[model samples]
Target: MSMFLVRSFDDPKGYIELNRPDGTLPRTSSESYVPWGVSTHGKIVYAKTGEHTGWRGGTGQHRLRPYDTTVSQNRRRQCQSELGVMILNNPSFTAKAVSKVSNAMRLYLQSQDAATAMACIYKQIGHYFYTGGRFGFGRISESKKDDIGVDGVWRGIMQALLLGRLDQKMSIHDAIGRKVLPVLKGGQLVKYTNLATVVRQDWFDDPTRRGRVNAPVRAPVTTKGGISKLDTPAGGTVAQGRNRGVDMFSRDLHRTRDKDADAYYDDADARNLLFGAGISGTTGTLLQAGIAFGKLTAAEDLKQYTLAIIGYLVGGGMHSYHETMAVASKVGVPYNPGAFETSMPESFRRSGLYTAWRANFYDIVVLGATHWRNNSGYLPSHLNKELTSPA
Candidate 1:
């Protein structure tokens, strides 16, 4: 059957030119003037390389062709409207969307000193893209078990809630709007769309630039007094009284993979760091393991994140080596040599195994707070809900 996407096509001669503005067109004698050298002679026909060279923009791939006028125009309009829709529907549209959620999470944290706004925002981003403002995770195409409790875009809601509730308001908007708009609009609130437009036009070419929302990693506490109850202890390590629970939890997560001490810990340091002392208990181990494994089973979240990034394409959610590390951080787990690098066998990375593992992980521990909130509410029921609802 023919797809509805066909309606979005516009001009047949307006093929997407992939070259830089000033770049030369391939087959046009490399002199740089034949920018539109590659043209589609007929509707739906692929562009053929002509004698004149057409240079590509930016990457210089030189794959320019004339798009079908009708198809190109329709697609262009649809894209613009869709982009606007995306901006308007973004979760962080208003202050309360961020503030209410962030505040909810702040109650559990001890201190907000040096808290990062970006980290909080990022946690929610995965949710935003995955849910696509629809709420439910829907049918996950792939499976992973390491994604914690989040299956879609709302995954980052926890971080946002935690950070937003802190003393400082964590805004994911531009500085200019932050300064001028408050007064410009006579104290009326601005939206993510407003801020994103500025960001898209100026500061960053890619809205989803990593480190754009820089989340600072807290320094590890060394002194005994500074340890949290979350930490579990180990033997033979002079760093006694260290609460290594989080670390220990990460190490012994996959019990089936390693019922033995050596299997539980990937390295001697991790094992020695958590062995012995009154700290290790069966109950504690079970509870901690449950939580850790919960984070590891992110199959659904992996599927959702992958789908979101692919569907959005141009939004700031592009894949990065750092995202895996970010997820590890959220779970309070440490990343090893294999998380970001292509070290894992292609079979492991590409196969549905990782995603399946992550999905289960998300289902157990982290609650899909944002997904539930947005989807189950009166959101889809009322257009005026945006006015009545906090977000």
Candidate 2:
């Protein structure tokens, strides 16, 4: 007898297909049978048929297959979530991005001629002060319109000047050079190494080129016992010779390991200055607009103050973290948060929570004020009447 197996779509049951009563198998074409199935709980069961060869000769084979689309989709989502978490937690992502930006900035700086770059920098600095003065005075003028007089104007001018001078003194370039570049370049390891190289080069370079001639040889003094000996002990004592050798070795090692430190610092500083100036210019413009239109209530003002503090903390923390990483990488030292905290400057270390807060807070305030001013404008009287009567 010939037989075939059949299975239900929704349940596990088997049915047997037997041969005809005349003891002959029925001939079945490939497309004679249609398979149907339904999806249960996002799982689909379908019948598949193929030819199978056995002792009874070749026969048609059918099987029910199950697949869950929802499970596959969920797995895909989980994989994406894990990827996002990995990217977020990876320090190299931030470091590489920041490095790329810094490199691009450096290339731009290099492309500009020295005269042009300096001119642009100076022009930007002037604009920063000018806009800053306007914003500072404008805020005061708006708040004390009734009380503002000649003396008030003078006071505003004086205050603006003072503020501008302060801003210039605490220049953004200073922050980039003293904080950003050092961290980005991996700290004093690079700086000291470069300095040592320069020192070694100078020590080895011939002084005759600069118009300094070698000292004349002194005559050897003859001892009373007829022992002739040159003064200064023929290149000084063994200890002095050893010290010189040690110094040269140290310098050579430094140069070999950190050859481009000084050059990197200079490039990094220039790039940072250019970038910082652009940011400052944008900030000044926003602050000027805010001073022109935004009204500050006590609550709103307090919120801004809080936001500014938060911004500073975030900015400073990022800077510190990157710097710590750079330093650790350069020195072959294991990274530790406590080490970074200890290495920070006294002012920054003491005000650990407030290190980058000032810059961040200022940015937030200007941006928030600009947003409020733009959105909280007075509605036209005509529009209000139209809305009330018709809509």
Candidate 3:
């Protein structure tokens, strides 16, 4: 006789199968086998080969038998329930709203010649500098003539364009790093049900994922005394503990403080410092050259307006290209302007129109409030004083 034992961790009493030497036997309770002494949380199967009356009186050596096992239905149900909850709480909806707003703001600003408006604002602030002739080492000496001349126009145009570019860069960075990338990564997490799977898929889809997967790989800057100079990722170890995508959003929004200097700098401030200097220097040099060679002339009202429009386009285009290239490089994707065509038809939809209208309305309200504030009190008076002050 031969006996086999079938055991499962979830069951305390295991079943047994008995067979005769001819491999045939009538199934009966007395012929069943029982485990003598074994305890485990995993499945185990044992078999005895020889004549046997029962498990307690078996006269043969016992050996393990193999069998297949399946995942419990309860576990699968739990996974499905978790997935449903995650889907319900997905952040993509909010991200899409933010994206629409950002795009709309970009369109509205472009429509209104933001660069020129920015230049006019700067002029109001810088009237004192313009009045002070030969005030600095810069070659554009203040003119004795009261009217804005070629040099002044070119300076204003360049400075305004620089500011506009800085603003556009900051907006794009915030929208992408804070909103777009996080939503995308979160969607992948929900789909894959694992971080490693999502990371691998991203790597496969775009090799540049290694560079821009929102993983905090960079070591934080530290002072000579080993104090951290800025806010770093929350993980005690690099790139392992925290959710990289969420941490990235936090880092982007984190404001850094200069303890020694008693100064505060946020992401916007840092970006401005990095991009503003380069844009201003490059554009200023170009404008100065144009003025020196008589390529640029004094602004008539129409010409001033035309120059502002041109400045807006040039400044906006350069910044857009820069942002596109940066993202492409980080994500291992080709920069393709043609991809925008896919969404062109949707731009005419009612929702799109509403978003556009809402964005423009926001801009108008902001501009009107700024105008009111500037015209109301100390600002206008101070500007007037600066304008009237002698060189």
Candidate 4:
């Protein structure tokens, strides 16, 4: 979210004005460099605070927050606030993935001779990444491991480490800022790691169920002289989308104007992350369905499932279900949208199993069915009662 003013030492042109509330105006002075420890950059030009156009001074701004200087209380506050959020957001698949594996263990212990443990384990694992965190039996109070941790923690950590390879694949913009800028500015501008890229790494690889970054790329640039020269030979960063992990799913898919046009999956990694955190295999699926519905599902399916799930979850009656079905039949695609709108019920839709199927290939087919229903003027009132009524 931090905006930076970028300029090359080699440029011969005049000053560039930043668009602010007042108007676009040139920046003047800049301060001596100091490192922002959050990135690899050894230093930053501290832009001075207060909005002023043109070259008033060379000092750059340093972000600061005024606070009471009580040492003991502040220490505790920092640990509880800043450190707590950091741990939660640090993208540790180990802690989370273990939670799901542990849940599978607990279910195995409880079921005894009744169920297949491996299937339960796989389903739980899939559910966790899709949902991003755990729910139901996966809830913190009900978690199986208590505080001991899962047996598979080491393996989970290894997988997270392996996926970190994607983090090393720099975006064209990032490489320009980090690797290229150092040499360009006579080494004065300094190379700093982009926070957006770091956050994107966490956001993209996160198995924590429902998370996604949907913002469009604000600026685009072709690589500079030597960089472009080398990139052409190296098979450069020519892909679409902001994050490499996110862009992986976009291959061969039709591009959309929407920010997350190509992020669809049969099951998302976010589910696994959550399941690892102790959410139920089932609950994770339901939450992933909501997120996937918003970001990844087809448009026609969006209209149908939004109405259907919202109606069911909100305690609307058979009549509401009927109305939802009516709209869905008219609007949803039949075959390509996933499962049949006729097959979805208030209880079943919230149950997690149904939503899991929807996240896969079923929803696409169902979207096609919805188009057919819309064209045929089908009334789904009777069908809703027949399918959704307690069986």
Whose TM-score is greatest here?
Answer: 4
Of the pair 3 and 4, which is ahead by TM-score? 4
Q: Which ten residues in a row have the lowest lDDT in candidate 4?
A: 270-279
lDDT of 1 by residue, 1-391 (tens): 1111111123343344343332212234432211122223222222332412333322133223433223332222232223222322332322233333234233322233223333333243333323332321111212221243343323333343343211112221112123322322321233323323321222112222111222133323232111122142211111112222222222112112212222222232221111111112211221122222122234333222222221121111111212222232332333342122121223333445333332222211111111121121221212222222211
User: Which window of 10 residues has the lowest lDDT sum in candidate 3?
Assistant: 272-281
- Pitting candidate 3 against candidate 4, the one with the higher lDDT is 3
Q: Any idea how many clashes model 4 has?
A: 70
Superpose all Cα atoms of candidate 2 onto the true structure and report the RMSD in Å to 1 decimal: 34.3
Once superposed on the true structure, which residue ranges of model 2 sit more than 4 Å away at CA?
1-124, 128-169, 172-320, 323-339, 347-391
How accurate locally is residue 302 in candidate 1, as Cα lDDT from 0 to 100?
29
Model 3 per-residue lDDT tens digits across residues 103-164:
43233234444565334323432333333453211112255324665345445434432332
Sequence-dependent TM-score of model 3? 0.16
In angstroms, how far off is 36's CA in candidate 4?
12
- Candidate 2 per-residue lDDT, tens place, 1-391, comes to 3222322333333223333343222335652221122133222222233422111211233232322232222222222222222222222322222223233334433455655543443333333323332322112233333244333433343344233222221223222223333333323225433433222322123222111122233222121110011222211111000111101111111121122333322232222211010001112221211221122223333223212211221121111122222222232222232112222223232342333322222111111111121122323323322222211
Ranking by TM-score: 4, 1, 2, 3
- lDDT value for candidate 1? 0.25
| Selected candidate, larger TM-score, 2 vs 4 | 4
